[model samples]
Structures are given as C-alpha cells and as structure tokens.
Target: MEQPFQFKQFLIHQDQCAMKIGTDGVLIGAWTSINENPVSILDIGAGTGVLSLMLAQRCMAEAIDALEIDDKAYEQCVRNFENSSWGDRLFCYHASLEEFADEIDDEYDLIISNPPFYSPSLVSTALQKGENSMSDARKKARFQDAMPFKHLIESVAKLLSKNGRFSVVVPFSEEEQFIKLASESNLFPLRILRVKGSPSSEIKRSLMEFTFSNSKIQSSELIIETTRHLYTEDYINLTKDFYLKM
Candidate 1:
C-alpha cells in the first residue's frame, strides 16, 4: 500500500484522489496571504484538503471549508480533513463551484484555489505532440474545461465577502488572462509572484492575491531552486511551516 504523506502536523492519504499532492498546491497553500486574520476560509477544488489543512496550521481561522467536485476526491478530502489536527475547524463539501455558489449564501473572508491549468488549446497541442501519459481522472482534475476560469472567477466573486481576499496559482502564461477575467468581476490583483523552477528556467507559475478594492499591484519573482534538489532560501522560508524537512 502507498503510505500517507506525512507533514509536520498532518498526514494526507492521496490514493483516492486523481490529483495527488503537488508543488503547486503546496506553494499556493504556503504562499497565500493570511495576515488579515480571516475568520473564515474556503479552499476551492480542494483535492486532498491539503491547502485547508495548511491554513488551519498557519492561522486561527475557526471555519475552514473545502469544495471538491469529484466523487472519490470528495470522499478522500473529507477523510483527510477528519484525519487532520484541526478536524474541528475543517469541513469538506462535495459539490462543484457552481452548485456550491448557488446554494450557499455564506461568504468567506478568505478564499484560495490551485485551479486547473491546462486549457483546451494546450491539451489539444499536447495531444498532437503525443504527450498521452495523463489519465482520464487527471485530465478532469487538470483541465480548464472541467472547471472553466470564467466559472471559477464568477463564483468566487459571489462567494467572497466585501472585504475578503482571494488567492490562486495559475500558469505563468495565464497570468494576464486570469487577471483580466478577475477584473470583469471587480476582483483586482493586489500582489503577484511569478515562480520558476531554477535560475535558468522560464517562469512556469504565478501566485496571485486579489481583493474587491483596487490597490497598487505588488509584483515579485521566486526561483524554487539553485540546482536540482537544492531549494532556494526564499522558497524554504515560505514553505518551512508545513514541509517536514524544510
């Protein structure tokens, strides 16, 4: 049997989840701004409930809710939340963002997501290139068509409190487009962090923070490693709270 992923304060069993725990989820979970002392939080597309678990460890948020659309992933997310130290504060909802947004009237003080990155164009291109290693379940978990960016942003706009903040991680290529989509809902970017694998690698991801009010956009970059397996100091400092070996 595959062993559960052991963190400093929690264990995650990802066998039932299509999208296993990954660096993007960890980065967004650890990189998200929680200094506002948000009383309530919501984790969209919560695969293994890792992001919610991380926030529970980092903040005193009394209510931490997670939304998972897939059947197996939803069950596993609930299990993960129950297995965590903050079980009392964590809850998982098994529903798509659209359904949840339409049914729930409660607004969150903080909302975060590590959303699907592969758009239809990218998927088509990859398929043409014979990059067929991904499974069906993973395609649902990683493809934009499964949870469109427009749908995600619109739901987030409705689900966030007037003073709430939303954070997310997306492909660096999608940064401009994502920001534009968010702006349509009046959600403006407050900060952005572009991430690269190494000093010589092209930017691959973007960590973004958005709010209802307009403000000066703070931009920065993060290079994860100086070389293979050698994590950068900035990366270490950002994620040290959750990673066991950091």
Candidate 2:
C-alpha cells in the first residue's frame, strides 16, 4: 500500500520508503538559504524527493536534481518527482553520493542533505523502543558508515560551485564534530540553527549550512513546540506555507 503524505502544494507517495517525511527534512528544506537565485540545485540522499520539490516550488531554480541510493526510496522519489508540477525540471538519480560525485563533473549552485545521523554501531532510541524497526534501507538511510561526514564534506568540496551553498540536519550533539570535519575540507559554516522540542527541553537537532568561504557565521535557536502537539509561533511561521495544517 502506498501511503501518501499530503502537502499544501504536492502529495508525496512514501509507503515504499523506509525513511518517511519528518520534521527534520522539512526544517532543513524550509530553513536552507536560497537568496542567491541558484540556477541548479541538488538534494543528496533525497527521501521521497521532498526537499527538491519544496525548493522547486519556492524558487525559480530551473534544475532540481536528487540522488538516492536505496532501491525502493529511489523509485518512490522518482515517482514523487514526476508527479509534481515541476516534473519537467526535476530529475532523480539512483546512486549513492560517492557514485554520483564520481560520475558527475558538474557543480551545483545549492546542495542540501538530511543525512543519516546515527553511526552504524549505534542504535537510536526509536529502534530500541520498537518505534522503528531496523531494516537495510532504514540503516542505510541513517547510518554514518553508509555515508560518512568526511565523505559528504569532501564531495561537497568538489561538487559545489565556487559561490554555492550546502546545508544539512543532524543530531545537535554531532554539530561540533560535523563542523570540524567540514572545516578540514575547506567548507566553512555560514549559518547554524539549534532545534529543541520545547523551551525547557534539551537541544535535539542541529541544522547547518556551509560554503567555500570562511564568512561570519549566523547562529540561532528554534523551538518547535511549546507543548505536545502545540507548535510555537516561530515554528509555525517557518513551515506554514508547506505543512497542510501548520
């Protein structure tokens, strides 16, 4: 059965995808900077192609390309892309980041990723609690070994255009290590957003953006909910246009 996620502008068919659409993808997709009027964009590990679709709807970027490694997710992402209004301008490549980077010599003006966060050796709380059943696709979607930060940063260094921008979302605790790895590849932080579930809750996720230059970093915080199922005004404002009921 294909469970479809309803968005304001487009519906995403994601039953075949192990990693369904979640707040992290939406947060990074909506929060990533796009002011430069990029002519081409790339979505790394695009799950259901939501980020590419959102950017296509939000900007005039003529080319929105996505890369996915998982067999099922890649097919679903292609289906989602072709079903969208921007199908003529959108395309999906069924390949790993390394494979895509190795084959393609073109640079992207904007590249975005909501990469797998947990290391292959670690199990997430959701997995331990039985909330998410671990599978090959899910593991490949969330494991560090599947797409290491070092590999991702190095690819960005080579694939991103000189004036391009790159963005991603990962666990807040990994922020320091992720930035350090990026700096080694000469990709400096441009903006950082630390996200919390509630005002009193500990920081949960970090949404980061980078570029080739060592520009002044813009840092900030985002609280998604003031209480369970109740969103903050800022959160509402940031994602209102895309979420059906936001």
Candidate 3:
C-alpha cells in the first residue's frame, strides 16, 4: 500500500488515485485566499481529498465539499476525508462538475482546483489507436478533455457566491487561454503567481485567484528551489504551515 502523505495537521492516502499528491495541489490549497473567511468552500476534481483536507486545517469553513468524477478516486477521496481530523467539515461527492453544478443550488464562498494539464496534441495522441496506452483513470485525471477549461469556468461561475473567490493552478502555457475563458464568465483574475522549478528554469505553472468583480491584479513569481532538493525561502515560507519539515 502507498503510504499517506503526512502534513502538519492531516494525512492524505492517495494509493487509489490516478494522480498522486503533487506540488500543484499543495500550492493552490495553501495559496488560496481565505481573507474573506468563507463559511463554505468547494474543491473541484478532488483526487484524494487532499485539497479539501488542507483547507479544513487552514480555515474554519463549516462546509468543505469536494467533487470527484473517477470511481476509485472518489472512493479514496471520501476515505481520506473521513480519516482527517476535520472529518465533520469535509465531504466528498462522486459526480462530474457539470452534473454537480446543474443539480446543486447552493453557492460556495471559495473554490479551488488543480485542474488537468495535458496538452491538446498529447490528448489527441492518447485517443488514437496503438498510441501510448494511458489508463482510463489517468486519462480522466490528467487530460483537459475530461474537464475542459470552458466547462470548468462556466460551472464555477454558476456555483460561486457573489463575493466568492476561485483559485486554480494550471500550466503556465495555458494561463493566457484559461484567463480568456474565465473572463467570458465574468471571473476576473485578482492574482497570478507564476511558479518555476528553479531560478534558471522556465515558468512551469500559474497559480491564479479569481473573483466576480475586477480589481488591480496582483502578479508575482515563485521559484521552488535554488538547487536540486534545496527549497527556496519564498517556497518554504508560503508552505510552512502545512509542510511538516518546513
């Protein structure tokens, strides 16, 4: 069995999940704005419910809901949530974003996601016969076609409260396109944090926070390491609360 990822206040068992615990999820969970003191928070595509668990530990949100589409992932997510210290506050729903958005009338005060990031060409190749045979679980977890940017943005717009803020981490290359899609739904970017593996490496990811109303954008950059396995001060400071050895 895969060991659970031990955080300062919680543990996440991701043995059944297609995508294991990753830096992107941790970054979004820790970096998401809780300044509004949200009473309810939603985590879309919750794999092992790690993001929801993280939020529950970080804030006093009474309702921390997660939505997962994959069967195994959903089951693991629920199990992980139940095992956490804040089980009362964490709940997992096994449903696609579209179905959940259409059925649920309640709105969330805060939303977070580490969405799938495979490129279109790669997704196309995966679909072709005799190509690199990716498993169904991993396909759904990593391919954008499983939960397209337009669909995600539209669903989030409908499910978010008027003052709610949505935070997500996506490929830096998709930042421009994703923002355009979000703007179509009136979700303006409030902050953008570009992340690089090292100071010399190219930006690899974009952590973005959005809201209903437009405002002056707060843009910044983060380099995770100064050298191999050597974390940078900014990365450590930002994640010190959740990471055990920070």
Best by lDDT: 1
- Candidate 2 vs. true structure, TM-score: 0.95
Candidate 2 residue lDDT tens string, 74-139: 999999988999999899998888888999999999999998888543556557878366777777
TM-score of 3: 0.95
Question: Which prediction has more favorable lDDT, 1 or 3?
Answer: 1
lDDT of 3 by residue, 74-130 (tens): 998988888888999988999999999999999999999998887695556556755
lDDT (CA) per prediction = 0.93, 0.90, 0.91
Error of 2 at 14 (Å): 0.3
Which residues of candidate 3, in runs, are more than 4 Å off?
121-133
- The root-mean-square deviation over C-alpha atoms between each candidate and the true structure, in angstroms, is 1.0, 1.7, 2.2
Whole-model lDDT, model 1: 0.93
Per-residue lDDT over 23-140 for candidate 1, one digit per residue giving the tens place of the 0 to 100 score:
9999999989988999999999999999999999999999999999999999998998888789999999998898999999999999999988887768887787775688888889
lDDT, residue 164, model 2: 96
Q: Which ranges in model 2 have alpha carbons more than 4 Å from their true place? A: 120-133
lDDT of 2 at 58: 89
